[model samples]
Target: MEAPLVAALGALIAVVEACGAAVVVVGALSGGPARRARS
Candidate 1:
């Protein structure tokens, strides 16, 4: 019982980290073009 709960929590953490990384990558890609256009 407890083991299953711990596994689920670990999986959730991994998903959150992946999502954060994706957001960072997208922001960096989009921000570069916008900055260049302004300059």
Candidate 2:
């Protein structure tokens, strides 16, 4: 009972961390192009 709940919470935390990393990576990649365009 409690074990399953703990596992679910862990998975959710992992997913959120992954998504945050992905967003940071995408933002970094796109920012380079925008900077070039500005120059």
Number of the top lDDT candidate: 1
TM-score of each: 0.88, 0.86
The TM-score of candidate 1 is: 0.88
Question: Could you give candidate 2's per-residue lDDT for residues 1-39 as a string of tens digits?
Answer: 899999999999999999999999999999989999999
Q: Tell me how far candidate 2 lies from the true structure as C-alpha RMSD in angstroms.
A: 1.0
Worst 10 residues of 1 by lDDT: 27-36
For candidate 2, give the lDDT: 0.98
Which one wins on TM-score? Answer: 1
Question: How well does candidate 1 score on lDDT at residue 10?
Answer: 100
Expressed as tens digits, the lDDT of each residue in 1-39 for candidate 1 is 899999999999999999999999999999999999999
Worst 10 residues of 2 by lDDT: 27-36
As for candidate 2, its clashing pairs are none
What ranges in model 2 sit over 4 Å off?
none
